[model samples]
Target: MTAPVDIERARFNMIEQQIRPWDVLDLDVLGLLNEVKREEFVPPAHKALAFVDMEIPLLPDTDEALKNGHCMLPPKVEARLLQDLAPKAHEKVLEVGAGSGYMAALLASRAQRVITLELHPELARMARENLQQAGIRNVEVREADGSKGLAAEGPFDAILLSGSVHEVPQALLQQLKVGGRLAAIVGDLPVMRATFVTRTGEAGWETRQPWDIAAPRLAGFPEASRFHF
Candidate 1:
């Protein structure tokens, strides 16, 4: 029989080897990485893979939509994104994907409130149950298409797209309060970059692409058209 995995050791290695090296140096973000048990949010079959450096599938292998698999972003990516947005204690954050609520749980530890939207119903239910079980009260998971963002609950202090997209939607940008920051992975495969946008004024915005990273495409967002030659 296989020996039980050393959970804490693996968690430490994940932080030291993967996360910290990636420049996720914020104390609060790093500390939350320890406080929130990633394994708890992972599916049962994938519990051991929680601390691994790859995306963990949230759905069953036999599920058709999961042919490529709907998954939680890798730990380092999640930590880095969380660090970039830097949600404050009084700020309200909007997370566009609620895979299993792990990211929302992280956001909730720092932000006053977090509204996470999940397009998949099963994933939404999973997120809600996980958050409830974790005793996290500040996160609300909405089962709706997040590609357009939550406008009715607008003017968030920070917004994070937990998945990659072709481009950051203007609707989502318009929802940010002035001075609010939004982080997302934009562009297509093999060349995607992490894009950060800050709302500068009522009709002004600034963008920065700090690093390159590619992730599975998030569904439901409008696709950019291309004409075949």
Candidate 2:
């Protein structure tokens, strides 16, 4: 009896109402949000809740993350962080968690190339498919633990951590170009803040704390992660 949903209007409202009110008003960033369909990246079952202001499940428990019920963050948060990253034309951007490939797609729209890391192989494969479907040619999805960072793809122009960290790994800081910026949400739930660290020079990185928000924890990065003991 329910009507078939209108996906395009939902995407428009999601951008104008939920994400924009969260202080994500940059035209370029907003345009990217409009261009990328979050619903398309969502799993078939969760497609309906794609525009909702909460996390959505990607898989049903074939992985460790599914056992934990850790879903993707709200669209507004992604928009805000992407705005802070400010990736430029012809720059290489690195993303730690591929998730649904939403962030990677966003980066592909602005950057020359995106080297993204993913812990879950299923997620990585799905992301690759989504990117292909979306016609995003610049994103390369890989299966790897982000705790180690991407050593082989070092010296990137921009780095983005797809989830929150209690503290960013010192190793990740070393991977950026002298002028590149790394954007990530840092801290625990209910009080985390998104930060941007710009590599000012050798042995020095300028940091900025922008948003006091919360996102799912990055799978790897035990060095920057909190102590269980």
Candidate 3:
């Protein structure tokens, strides 16, 4: 059994070694990383991997795990995305994947309100329960496909794709408010870039690729088709 001090030390080491080295230098984001108990949102059997710098499967049953898109992004990736997005206190945020509700909880800590969408019913239910247990009140988990952003909750201040995508869906881009930012990891396996898109005007948008990292493809997103020449 792990002691409290051991867990705390591991958490500290994660921040100092994994997160900070990744250039996640935002003080607020760093502080929130410490404040939120990641271990609580992780599966009990994988609690020891809570601070590891790799994707941790959310489902206890390995066979149904990655297939369901139930996995937490590496701690550093989560922190870097949050820092880059810089969600404000008065902003409304949207998260595409709610694996364990951990990212939603992080966004909720900075934003006024957060709505996270999950495709799997069981995962959504678990996310809700985890958020409730964490005492996170401003996050709402919806069981729905996030390929197209939530239309009724349009004009979100910021949007986040908690997983990777072959390309950013136009439907989601249309949901962002002018000046709103959308962060997503885009590209195929072995090589993916973390990109940010900002709505500049009614018909204009700006995109940037700040870093490269690979993550599992978000479920329900359209896949590129093969064509014979």
Question: In terms of TM-score, which candidate is strongest?
Answer: 3
Kindly report which residue pairs in candidate 3 clash with one another: none
Q: Pick the candidate with the highest lDDT.
A: 3
- Mind giving the per-residue lDDT tens digits that candidate 2 earns over 70-179? 45778888888888898999899999988889889998899999999888888899899999998889899999987677878889999999888888988989999999
What order do candidates take by lDDT, descending?
Answer: 3, 1, 2
Report the C-alpha lDDT of model 1 over 1-229, residue by residue, as the tens digit.
4324698899999999999999999988999999998988999998989999998889886355343337889999999999988899999999988989999999999999999999889999999999999899999999888888989999999999988889888999999999999999999877999999999999999999999998877778766788777
Superposition error at 18 for model 2 (Å): 0.8
Residue 4 Cα positional deviation in candidate 1, in Å, after optimal superposition: 7.8
Clashing pairs in 1: none
lDDT for each of the candidates? 0.90, 0.84, 0.93
Off by over 4 Å in 1: 1-5, 62-69
CA RMSD per model (angstroms) = 2.7, 3.3, 1.7
* Candidate 2 weakest ten by summed lDDT: 62-71
